[model samples]
Target: MKKTTSFVSIGTIILLLFIHGCSGCKKEAQNLSDSPKKTFIGPFMNEDSILLYVQKQLECGPRNPGSNGHSSCKEFLINFLKTKADTAFLQTFSSMVYGRTYEMSNIVASFSPDKKDRILLCAHWDSRPFADEDETPSKRTLPILGANDGASGVAVLLEMARTLSISKPNIGIDIILFDGEDLGLSGDLNGFFQGSRFASKNYPLPKPKYGILLDLVGDKQAEFRYEPLSQQAHFVLVDNIWSIAKERGSPYFIHETGNSVSDDHVMLNEQGIRTINIIDVNLVGNISTNPRRTYWHTSRDILDNLSMQTMSDVGNVLLDFLFTTSDSVY
Candidate 1:
């Protein structure tokens, strides 16, 4: 996805505020009550397993749309999720990008399918078709391996799914692996988020209450600041997740506000899902002090740049929030 100054209009912002205000009042009243919080014990996210999942995706090569790697990875993800989740399926559609009509599918896996209260966790599984950000102009046309950009988030969720299969959470969970997220050329917003736009329009039953999107999150130097769009769309969700990270003494989840990103979560928020993104803000945009910025959309985005410890931290935080947090908080 590309960076943008603003996506939501003033009128839309006001409507969102009104909607959130009504719900916020009810949650506030619930928070005031002296209800005991639930305690959850589950298997720890294995760092080795997380690394193995990332390696498995990279083994499929660059999963760009219409490529052999994309086809293989799609089957692998679907088959894997089907074994772990209560229900898993594909949402298929065709879209024309850069004058080419490509078949794409969003891999969706649901846990506790009958539960009314649920949350969403998602990541793009498709790698960029071209390394537009490569410093070597000659290499710009090649596809990126996307170990960090694509596979990392999916790897974390795969591990989460494995753990959830063993120990179910109180609330339902939907893990969606979005396709064609990086098919866009630089500055071409319409080419991006193809899967999210479609999924938002055709939501599944037992819709999620809120969502947390993971992107550019497995790099060794990754730092997650409060993304502006996420903060504006769902401040409470952001605060709660960040608070959990801090309580765990995490060095990655910084409390300061960061850059605005136009990503898949934007599409979900537009559909009134109130989703937030947990991304390495500096690495995605043009400016950054981190060296990993050079890897964005570049052929250098390989398995060497990923960090299993970083992925585990993100997964642990989500598990804590999902299992321990009271039902009323959601």
Candidate 2:
């Protein structure tokens, strides 16, 4: 994911105000319900299992396109998804970067394919080819391991898949691990989100009602805020997820709005898919006060810098949201 800008547009502020007003009305409507709230039971997410998935991805080395690690990791992810998902496959495409053509594949796994009501969960799986943000000038040309930027989100989704395999949700779920998300050079927006661009153009059958994207979610000091683009695309879905986090007393999901990001979700939204990004924007660009921001696109983004507890927090919120909410809620 790339930080497009630190400032929010005027239109976004107006939209946010409108949403806030509507939320008040919705709350009033909910208060009139005499029926008691239903308890949502979801499968437990094991932190140890999630960490192991991250470790296994790192074991394959940097997953940059045209590298051996890329090929091996692709095989590993596809095989693992096949074991758990009712239907799992790869969407292959080609892209030209820096005057060279490269082959890329987006790994997709579907649960309860027959169900028409569906939601999409996605994250980028490819590591950056160059550590452009590394403090050391010499290391800028080297590839990063992307323990938090890439592997973290994928790890959470893999764990979700494992649990979903054990206990199915009422609604259909689609997990897509988008490739080539970190291929862009500094400030080159066109080079990013190649896999998402292709996938959005050729959407899967039985399209999802809404989508959530996870990125940089494993940092020990991760703080997720409302991304403006997400709120603009589907403010109700964003409010619903955040409200769930608030109910669960999650410290990671902040109620305040954060910086806008140019990521895979942006590509999907452009294609008319209402997608929101759950990412730690503070750990990405210049506005961050967190010390871990140093690890962005750097060699320092290793397994040691990640926190299983942080990933579990985000994962649990997703589980609760998926299991508790009905199709009408979103």
Q: TM-score per candidate, in order?
A: 0.87, 0.87
Query: Best lDDT goes to which candidate?
Result: 2
Q: Model 1, 119-195: lDDT tens per residue?
A: 99999999999999998999999999999889999999999999989988889999999999999989989999988
In order, candidate lDDTs are 0.86, 0.87
Candidate 1 ranges beyond 4 A from true positions: 1-41
Candidate 2 lDDT over residue span 75-191, tens digit each: 999999999999999999999987888899999999999998999999999999999988899999999999998999999999999989998879999999999999998898989
**285: Cα error in model 2, Å:** 1.6
Please report, as a residue range, the 10-residue window in candidate 1 with the lowest summed lDDT. Answer: 1-10
Q: Which residue pairs overlap in candidate 1's backbone?
A: none
Q: For model 2, state the Cα shift of residue 290 in Å.
A: 3.0
Model 2: clashing residue pairs? none
Candidate with maximal TM-score: 2
